[model samples]
Target chain A: MSDSKAIFLKDAAVNAADGDQRAFIRKALGGYYVNRDLQKARYRDWERARDAASLAKWSAVNDLAAVLEQFVANFERNGGVVHWARDAAEARDIILKIAADNQAKAIVKSKCMTSEEIHLNDALEKAGYGVVESDLGEFIQQLRGEAPYHFVFPCMHVKREAISELFTKHLGTAPTDSPEELTMIARRHLRQLYVDADIGITGANFLVAETGQISITENEGNARLTAALPRIHVALSGIEKVVRHLDDLSVLLPMLATAGAGQPMTCYNTLYSGPRKEGECDGPEQFHLVLLDNSRTRLLADPEQRDALHCIRCGACLNVCPIFKNIGGLAYGTTYQGPIGSVITPHLRGLKQWNHLSGASSLCGACTDACPVRIDLHHHLLHNRRNAAKEAPTLFDRVFHHGFNFVIKRPWLFAAGGRIFRATLPLLQKLPLPYMGAWMKTRDLPEAPARSFRDQWKNPDA
Target chain B: MPDARSDIFARIREALKVKAPRPHLKGEPVAGKTSAAAKPWLPDGGESAEASLAILAEQLAKLKAMLIRVPDHASAAKAVAELAAAKNWKKVAYHGHPLLRPVAAALPCEAWEADASFEKQRLEGCDAGLTTCESIVAQLGAILVSSASSGGRALSILPHAHVVVAEAAQVVPDLGSALALAKARHGDQMPSMLSFITGPSRTGDIERILVLGAHGPKELYLVLVG
Candidate 1:
């Protein structure tokens, strides 16, 4: 195994045993499930809605180039500029150039996992620009200098008291444990930042091809303020965010909210076509849409795993994933932290380095069932495992599999082997073999029967 | 940049070479076959304008937004005055739309003009904002406000309270119809910003507890006029 993969496994094991993290995940996901169930109940034909959304995404993926061309044309027609980035570094450079050109000193940003994917805040801060995260969850995570704990809820693992402490330390407010007070404190603090910011940065939920509008959905109204209050607006999005029609939001919006937070709809779903129009006074003067490929094309190149690109990022799989619930989002040590993350991270990064993530699953298929786009996630994990094994085979793996196959093929050898294994179970338990010891740490081998079932079947009269 | 775009497109085309070209998708892509095959889901009162208005009121009330129905523009004006008085609002910022002239005229407060040149700092100081919506969505109880007609964006967001002046005819059954209306009205060139404001700004990010007015308006009131 790679050194980073080994470290990741060790860290994941420690995080899985953390009682507080586990409790937080359970409570938060439990509430999420309740809300999802209630909101999903409103739809008489939920499955049909899912299918329609899936088809729309599939169509977009199939004709991505044409759709993106159309999007660029339409957006540019509305006075928006579009840039193409082959990877993260290019995406970051393009953004920095925009900031430098505009002489921006301060930037306000909305919650965008895409921005997280590219480490945009770190780059911006390093360049001497004051950056403020406007989403309440993202702001909390930012104050603590941590990555998001969940896809939808960035600070889900953080308690109110911790947030109160964070605010007291950072914003210099009197410590208060109330969620409402903490939210208000953040709101009051970030309110001025929006007005002072020279630039606003955001991630798009969907890019409409028919109209070339970038749609963003939020509950706190920060995105609206971020886009509206600034002189320049830059939206950084993965090229996968495109949808074919404006009407597609009718299905995508509800599906995303119901799956992510169990709301009928988010409080705000705004579509931005471009910069301020000729007569408009409040929107950004310059609007730029940066389309980042960043290894998404690698995933698209594989026909078997291409459907994984259909992810809407609703994070339903994370909420329902057993492995995710136990190990938590930070355990993965990647920007994305669940089934969809596991499926695509290998392609986005390198497969050999990230193969361990695919092995983390129990293959419960809950993630597949939860997926709105119906990407066969567990099967894809199996495929990833197979690919990993093919890429790097060890001598021990070859020997063990060959020996097992030989014994299974011979009935007499298998019977004798089974009897010997049962008799030596206690001895094996005490053996200091590294692999065996690791397996026995949290589990015990089942007690061996007095006799083998095959032996008893052959000599029942005895 | 052009090289990168072409390279990405070339890779995509190579990957999709094995699949049959779907010629039927040439023109404007048709709405997905799935959406047409199975009847799309709609809320309880998402049938007609009258039924949708009732449902919109109920849904908005559940989201902590007040919905007041009036017989005509004059009554809507009266409702706005009563609401402002009850809330003890002393300063109101109103969108410079002809539809909202009646309410602005009847407001019992120092009214501020929300125009293209209106100062955002002053709008932030107002007690409430009065604006007109492009449409009201019944299923989600959302008010659709576009930058084209709503005196830009800050008028509806920066104030402590937001009061929307909408007409009964502007109510839509669901988000689908709302999008259709927007498309029909604007065609290919959409406004700079179009927002669907469901209620006062809110957040449940802290311990999954819902808190209203995290950043935007603390109160949202809808005055539906004939």
Candidate 2:
């Protein structure tokens, strides 16, 4: 393993064992699972909805070229500008240019995972613009100068007391710890920023090809203000977010809400077709949509693993993942986390450095089951592991596998090896074995039998 | 930009060289005709409009939005006055919808025009904003407001409290019906912004505790007129 990866795993292992963090995650995610189950029960045929949504996404990915063209045409027809970005640098440049052209001094942003993927906030900050995150969770994370703890819940790991401290330190609010009071404090502070900001930046949940509109779903209503009050509005999204029909939201919206937050629908599901229309009083005067292709085509290039692009970023896999619940979101050390993150990060970033993430899972199929788009996420992790091994196999792995294959193929040698292992179990346990010690850190080794099952089969009486 | 677009498309075509043919791209409306067939799996609120309205009310209440049923536009105006008085709002900003003239006239306090020039200073000064909705979703208890009918996105979002006036005829069974209505009304030219609001602005980001009015209206009230 790379030194960085080894250190990351070590840090994650230590963090996973923290009692307070474990308790917080368990309580928070447990409540989420309960609410999700209750909300899902309201649907008569959730599985059918999931299947149809998956099919729609599959069709969109298949006809991506035509669909994207149609979206651009319709968007332009509605007075929206579309910018194609081949990489993160290009995308950043496009946004920076817009900000520079407008002479924008302040910017308000809603929660967008794609923005997190591109590190847009840091880039914009470096350019000397005052960029503020409007989403409450993201606002807290930003104030603490930390990355998001979870995809949906950016500050899920932070406790209320920490938030009270954060507010006191950052906003200079009274030492009020109540959630409602804290929300009001943020609302009062950010409401002014929204009005004064020259630019608003957001992420699109879905891009409708037929109408040339971008759908943004949120409960906090920050996205609405961010899209409405600014003179310039820019939406950054991965090309995979495109959907074939506007009616697709009928199925996709509920699926996303139920899977993401256990709601039938978020409070605000706004579709921006273009900039403010000819007679419109509010909304941005200029609207720009940036379609980013940062190593996504690489995943699309592999037919076998292409379905990984179907992920909706609902984060259900993370909520249900045992490893994530234990080790937490920060452990993955990538933009996306949990099962979907592990499967795609290697491809999105690079395999050699991130290949270790594919090994983080127990290969359980919960992620596949929870996936609304039916991405077969766990199987994708397996594919990543196989590809990683093929790309660069270490000498230790080769030697161990070859030795294991040789002994297992010979019956007599296998039996002899088993006997030897059972006899030396005490010695092995006594010795400070490196690998076995690490394995035994969180688990117990099963006791070896007195004799092999093969031995018994050959001579039962003995 | 053009080069990047073409290059990405070329890569996609190369990657999908041996893929299946896309049937939906052939000018056949896959969702248009088969929407009904796809409707069987969706939740059934009711077959009658009355039943759907009941479900809508129940759902909206669950989301913490106040829903008041009025007999007609006159009563809607009265309800608006009563609500404004209860909230002690002295000044109200209202969208210039012809249907909302009665509510504007009946307002007990000073009413301000929410027009194109309605800037942040005016919105902040106003205690409440009144607007009209295009439709309401019964299944999810969502109010559908478009820039065409609701004045603009800011009217429904920026005020301390947002009050929406809607006719019972505008209620629909689900989001699909809402989309159908928009398609029929505007055809190729849609409003720049179409928002579906379920309740007051809220967040659960701080310790997963529910809090209202994160960055929009702290209070949401629906006055449904028949």
Candidate 3:
């Protein structure tokens, strides 16, 4: 087994038994499920809306090169600078160079998972920049010196008492159990940093081709201030974020809200065309958009699973995945978690090392049903498993299959083995037998089937 | 390194050769095959203006946003004065706009205009921010505010409470129309920033529990005048 897969098994076992962690995930997601259904009903037709949303992303992703080229031209025309990074290292260097050129002292950021994917915070902090996460969950996670527990709800696993303790240790604020009060503590703290920071970094939810604007959707308004207060604004986005037109957002944004968060609309969905234009009141003076490919083109190369790139990062799949609900996000150990992550991690990382993620599923279609853009998630996992076996089947896999084939080819040997297995079935079931024991813990070896298929065929109605 | 721009494009070009089709549109891998819906996929505000207004009010109520309607601009100003007196606002921040200047003037407290350029600290210190919006959406009770129209981005977002003053004519039925309106208003000179604000700043981040005013205004009031 791969190193990542081993870590995943160990973590999954521990987390699945963590009563406190399980309760937090269940309670939080219970609310999300209720709200999502209620808000979904607000749509004229939810399934039809899903199809429309899917096509909107499909059109952009299928015609990716054209739409991206158009977007780049229009964005540059809008007086914003565009930087293309081939991989994570290049993306990190590009952002560092931008900061150095701007002579930035401090940086504030809204929640951008792409940044996390490239480890931008670590890169920037190593280069002697004080980077602060402005999104409340991200802020808490940052203060705790941890990765986001969940991508969207960054610190979902943390209790309020723990959060209060974290704040007291870090920010030196009075301890409070109130979620609202804890939010105010961060708000009060980040306000000054926003004013002082020379650079603000953010993530783009959708990059509109026609208008050349990046739309950022968030429930809190931190993204607004992060983009507004800083003199230099830098946004990092994956190349797959492009949508065909401004009107596409009109369809995509509502579904993202309802499916992801169960809201009529998130509190803020802002479009940024450029730096503060001439004759504008206040905004960043220089706008830089870094478009990172970072092996996404590799995923794009696989036509069978190409629509996985259509993910809006609304995280609806993560919310509904039974595996995610049980094992939690940390165990996945990828930048993205849940079904979407499992389907694409092999493509984004590598097939051999990450293929175990595909096996982690129960072939449940909850994620496919929950996806706003209708990426065939479960089928993609199956494809990953097949491709992995074809590409590099382990020696154990080969030997086991060979042994089974050798026995099955000889009818007498197979019959003898079956007779022995049936006779010892009760003992085998009772004994704790390593791998077989684990398997049989949740399953039963069906009552020895009374007689074998050959015996049943020989007798008329045995 | 290796001309990232052209290289990335080359990879994309090569990748796009083998087209992937949506399940329903399998023959030739149709680009932009938008499914024609029998009814509008999103909630709609009927054909009439009154219908739009009624839906907008109901949506706003659900969002916990206060919507104030007035017969005229003078009543709008009076409403602001009364709200300030009731809330006991110490200082208010606003930008120079014909629609909202009077409302700011009636604040009966230190009113600061964040004009073309202003200090961030001054805006941050204000109790409430009053600004003009480009358009309001009735479908989701979303207010579309642009940097050019709303005295820049900070005025609508920086303060404790954001009270937007809009005319009834500015109300649109849906988000798509709101974007169309922006396109008509700005053409190529689009505002550096355009934000669709649904409710006050909020987060369900902490334990996935709802909490308002995470990093922006806690209270949001929309004052509409006819």
TM-score: which candidate is best? 2
Error of 3 at B133 (Å): 0.8
What is the DockQ score of candidate 1, to 2 decimals? 0.53
- TM-score of chain B, per candidate? 0.87, 0.91, 0.92
DockQ of each: 0.53, 0.58, 0.67
Clashes (N, CA, C under 3 Å) per candidate: 0, 0, 0
What TM-score fits each model? 0.95, 0.96, 0.96
Best by lDDT: 3
Cα lDDT over the full model 1: 0.85
Task: Write candidate 1's Cα lDDT for B67-133 as tens digits.
Answer: 8889998899999999999999999988888878778989888887777467777777789989998
Docking class of 1: medium
> Which wins on lDDT, candidate 1 or candidate 2?
2
Q: Which DockQ-derived CAPRI band holds candidate 3?
A: medium
Query: Candidate 3's residue-wise lDDT over A1-462, tens digit each?
Result: 799999998998889888877887899888998988888877887877777778888888888989999999999999999999999999999999999988999999999999999999999999999999999999988988888877788888889999999999998999999998998898999999999999999999999998899999998899999999999999999999999878777778988998889998899999999998778768899999999998999999999999999999888998888888889888998999999999988988999889999988889898999998889999999999989988998886789878899999999999999899899988876776776644665677667777888888899675
lDDT of 2 by residue, A61-81 (tens): 877888888889999999988
The TM-score between candidate 1 and the true structure equals 0.95
